[model samples]
Target chain A: MLAALPNPQGVSVCPRRARWQLDLLLLALECVDLHASELMLQVLRELQLQGMIPNRVVFWQIRCTNPFRQVTQRTPLPLAETKALTAVVVQVARRQTAILRHLLLVLDQLQAQNLPPETYAPLAAYLDRFRRNFRKRMNLQRSSLFLYKNHQALNELGLKLLAQLLLCAGTKGMERLWFSLFDGEVS
Target chain B: MLLQRQYSLPNCTLRIEGLSGQAGAEQLDIVTCCEWEIIGQNQRIKGGKDFLVALLNSVPAAAQTWLSGVKLRRSPQYPIQVEIAAANQVSLHIPRKLLQTSPEENSESPTNDEAGETLEVHLTWLQLADLVEALDQFCSDSQTLPTLIPTFHSLPRRAIAPAVPLRKQLMPLGIGAASLAAMAAIFFHFPVPERRPPREEALPPTPEAVTPAPAPTTPNPPNP
Candidate 1:
């Protein structure tokens, strides 16, 4: 009988908190989209392929967000524009993945060289942790679109790992060689 | 101005000089690389016949084998001689400014001490290998080099160090140290005036009898 008395005010029909929840979801999606577009994995892959990176470097996914969903989130877009964006993202991702595979091969060779413990241990730990965490996070939700909500933290993780790799590699002159060669190759 | 090319490796330094006016009887179309002089070691040969003998004697057999791959020209239009003068020491004499001129034409230019410019590079063995390869490629295709002649003239004279007397070198340092000591003694030994409490005579009068000023009355009525 007490619950039935609430209908007298009629304020309960529209739940304001539900709208706020939707806004929060959109905000998170937008944040993930912004961060994914700025991901430096492609650039890092290029460096790795060119033999600049001394340590084992890995990126979980080149494009962490679904490109099609990211483009269609807010603004109404022509189907052609969305398709084109998706195509370009897919192409870039494929190339980046290829380069990453090549880099992994090179890393395998470096490991076979039996580099000192000072060099090997940190790289092994980094690869293991990154792979484990990335897999867990990406698989957390069955939904494809919402999986990238945590990408900002993932980007920070990548940058920290890269700095650590550089510290462990002791690759001062080697990077110069790679950069100089890259410049020449580009020119 | 003589441009001296100094290359630094991890363990040693390489100093290369073109044939100075005093280095040879004739401008031999040769540049020389030599290690820095050691404190107690015998001086290396200064003549042309065995300028590299001392350096050649010092390298490991592997490096010597690598050296053999490099062709040493008897009378290269421009030749660089590599030498090791002491343990872990390397010296290179690179004939500069002779781009492709014959010895006769090269002699027309002033000796390496006067007009030649030196290029100094610091690198490891790997970098050195890369440089050697680059140089080899450049030498093989000298005809492609544009502005070969005027490039040397554009180099500034400041690249060469000016001769300084030993007394001149020591004078400024001594003066600086003496000034520093004088400043230190002045700072430490100079009398520090004791900080005394302010005397009552020097104190400003305190307003002991002063009362707080009355709040001013406003002429205009407060806006309601």
Candidate 2:
């Protein structure tokens, strides 16, 4: 998003701190990319028609940076991975800038698709939770293993499991990839 | 100076960097939803709405997906008519000072009671899918959220005398935790009663003294 700048242009002459600023900006971009947005909704309609997101899922597409064709190569990207990516970018970001950075991540994701009702619900919910659970630790804990040690791993996994639980709750017509999750739990 | 806001509604903690130069760069974004049911047969329910609303509001601000939808559903619908006209487009420039500090009016941070915090988040396709998945998940879960032991202390033994799947214990938490699994359920089926007023005593009625006098007067007149 930083223009994918050729030769760094105006950015290079600035001090290393400025370079850090640029880094923060792009990291913010990544955060927006991973989350959901309005544009992503539009992308989903297209993806469903293209036969992505499992024949059962129908249309699971996103509005990512330019490579719409490349998306189908992957299906059902783990929500955690996106979050982790955001974490990396904002490793050194402070509170308010951190907020803008995270919002940008969300905005980027929106750019990838047309936002839908279902999309907004969970997306907003996720961001709200993040501010409570993660931001403080990252800021207060200063990148310690606290998130990992205290709750992140278990919470996220549990949430993922929860997601699987809810996703299967409605889609009786779809094939049971979720059952595999349960089966894995059972076995 | 940084703006600090705490919301118990969606369970969120937000620190808006009013002074970015001083604050550090360690931010976090979390998107999670949890729901369970607590059904009690008979009980006292003082703060079900506040409790659940507090829990929902407690959800952190960085949780973009659920924040966008779950929070949105919590409020009355707002009208949004997007105009796609090309003529309306305008280029705006940001002065250096403007970026340095937002207007004082824009200073307030997100909290539970505010209508703006839960308003719809405009997002992209991937994030939307995540949001949809999260939301479908929230509705599925919120419809039936986990019923903790009905106390700040969530543990069973810690909060109440533990109960088996259907074993009926005295439930130290009282009637609220007694019969049903859901706090909301117990509340609706059999609402907690309000205090009754004290009973009053009735005194005996006075006899018809006036009637006797009138009867005597009529008898005397007839005899005469």
Candidate 3:
């Protein structure tokens, strides 16, 4: 039974079972060349300052010059600092299943209050590009990307959510920009 | 070694040990300069074109520069001839000025091969003097980074088709469709092997009994 579950810290970025299927979809590689995790943290902090995302989201990625090599936590970032990066991810896609009671409300909020697609297209495109590149340890075991094991796998939940967020933001930016040029308000 | 040194000769040659992308990994061969050029260009050649170019190219700064990426200036007045000889190796014939002996302090004598050819300290002291000067003068303003070239690769993210085990509500229909298709494929791919009719081979045909009664009667009559 235990053998069936993926090794939580397997050296492989993606699981072996899903390789054939996953390899077929075109995803961009988001390579951050810096050895320090601080670089991504800085980007997160910058986004936080702008109120782009909330301060509680999960962020996980493998690091190494040769990604085929294993990813041990060679350079550990402090929890307080890493919290900010997590927040950045959550800011865009905040409809966690645990927050179920407020999911619809949050969805409404996004629909009503978020900036139109035109305003953030470039940044959205960049983030989308980041997501496409490099393999993620996409544990099909759970949709939420939990830090711990024993999580239930959902039917393509968070991935679709994150993808939607990136796409919407890009589309929203374009809409906002073009509309603003005409001095128009988004419907 | 001493004789080769005294005679102003070079022994070691450069060759391709291996090619990079083969499954077994590349083996670098110490070949002649011409062979090196051909190998570098990825054209196929056999034998000592490697060592010939190695020895001959080393004779002049201009010739060496052509082989090496470094830039050099030399006196054009005397040109040297580099040739490949009987053993399929290169020979460098120099005009004496290019050959300079270094101070042989704390140095061991050169080793020799079976052909009585000893290892020559290919580049002598005076021969390497201008190398430092050339590097300092020329390579001073090279970039901070080694010049990053962009690399393109194929990496797919999600499956081209939807994942298995769809929502619970859709399972029955999916399973029914799948099982029917599987049965259809099995029927088409494999017709019944030898026996088309399953019922015909159930029982074996019966054999007729031999008439021992007639033989018995005839034997009894003969005995009486």
* Per-model TM-score on C-alpha atoms: 0.18, 0.17, 0.16
> What digit string (tens of lDDT, one per residue) describes model 2 on residues A1-187?
1111122212222222222222223223333344422333333344342223332233222211211222223333332222222222222122223333244344444534654212554445543454343333223333433454444353342233222222222211011221111111111
- Give interface RMSD, every candidate, in order: 18.5, 16.2, 29.5
RMSD of 2: 28.9
Q: What ranges in model 2 sit over 4 Å off?
A: A1-83, A89-187, B1-224
Candidate 3 on B104-142: residue-level lDDT in tens? 321243322344332222221212212212212222212
Q: Chain A structural similarity (TM-score) per candidate?
A: 0.22, 0.19, 0.23
lDDT of 1 by residue, A59-134 (tens): 1111223222222122232222222222223323333333323333334345357542124443444344553445
C-alpha lDDT of residue A185 in model 3: 10
Model 3 lDDT on a 0 to 1 scale: 0.28
> Against the true chain A, what TM-score does chain A of candidate 1 give?
0.22
Residue A123 CA displacement from its true place in model 1, Å: 4.9
lDDT, candidate 1, at B223? 83
Residue-level lDDT tens digits of model 2 in B28-104: 11222222211111111112223233323322111222211111212212121111111111111112121222234
Question: How does residue A179 of candidate 2 score in lDDT?
Answer: 16
**Top-down lDDT ranking:** 1, 3, 2
Taking all chains together, the TM-score of candidate 2 against the true structure is 0.17
